[model samples]
Target: MLIKKAVLDGIASGDIDLLFRTWDAERVHAGSTQRTAIGVLAVDAVEETDPAELTEEDARRGGYASLDALRHDAETRDGTLYRITLHLAGEDPRIALRAEIPRGRELTALRDRVLHMGDWAVPTLEMIAAQPGVRAPDLAAQAGREKRPFKASVRRLKELGLTESLAVGYRLSPRGKAVLSAVRRATASA
Candidate 1:
């Protein structure tokens, strides 16, 4: 639902456009990787069902009906359909309340270990988060870097519990994002 909300936030408002502008600028400037990841995930997680085609406020109302049908379909197919209804199709706090999602690439000192972190930190966090819950190596490799830098950089994040271990790599912890949301909120409010 977070992913879905992120998509809605982008397309529904101009947040997606702002993100694209920032991402395009970032690519032109320096931190293309983070911007790229954000853009891609935003694009991919967006529902395949076209909101434009659906049209009207009916799309919003149809959300529940659509889920009911999907739920029934999943039940018949011997698949886990509640997951589709309850998880993905559901509204998310972070996405619905954009205040929870931090904008920009500002890094503040939450941990002494990460105080003077590298330029990659903010973007890395965004990248890891865009896919939330991948492994360290894969997350690093996903951002277009190598294993060593990815592993080294994720140390402070690990300490902060922003990421967790997978069989081969790492993925984001939900709590980590909640922390990020708080930090972003504090900064924005300030």
Candidate 2:
């Protein structure tokens, strides 16, 4: 479920508590948390709902100006209508993780993890570092890999706090730079 930046801001501000999506199946469950640029959102409930059953208040809580606007937007997608109740959970842990530079055991563990990602890891990091705001397809073409797998690889790096997604592309986080330096030194010695 992709929440828009505006809606995310609303969630963070406690002004929004509901989300409506059209999906073939439920994409999120009650208790599942989604990390967004703003922070983390905790899903409190997920239930099938009829558009007509949705009240104007529901629209407001969902960040829509009116029920008609909500219905209009929901109708644009094809799937079962699901009403999701949610709240801002907390800060995205990655925010903290991306800021911290690893050392000693942690550094070694992170380096090993990157090495296990195969030959593409270091090069990908270097490429992102070199061209911080390039589009993914362009980066993928430069790397001679398909866009999907390349994106997945980047996501893995992001999970490790070694990358930050930009509005258009990505850049190495502080942790990423530290890890990359450590990895380069270790590989050079080996």
Question: Which candidate leads the pack in TM-score?
Answer: 2
lDDT of 2 by residue, 44-82 (tens): 999999887989999999999989999998888998999
TM-score of 2: 0.92
Cα RMSD of all models vs. native, in order, equals 16.9, 1.6
The digit string of per-residue lDDT tens for model 1 on 115-157 reads 3466676667677667655666667676788978778777557
181: Cα error in model 2, Å = 1.2
Alpha carbon lDDT at 181, candidate 2: 92
Model 2, global lDDT: 0.93
Span of 10 residues, lowest total lDDT, candidate 1? 79-88
The top-ranked prediction according to lDDT is 2
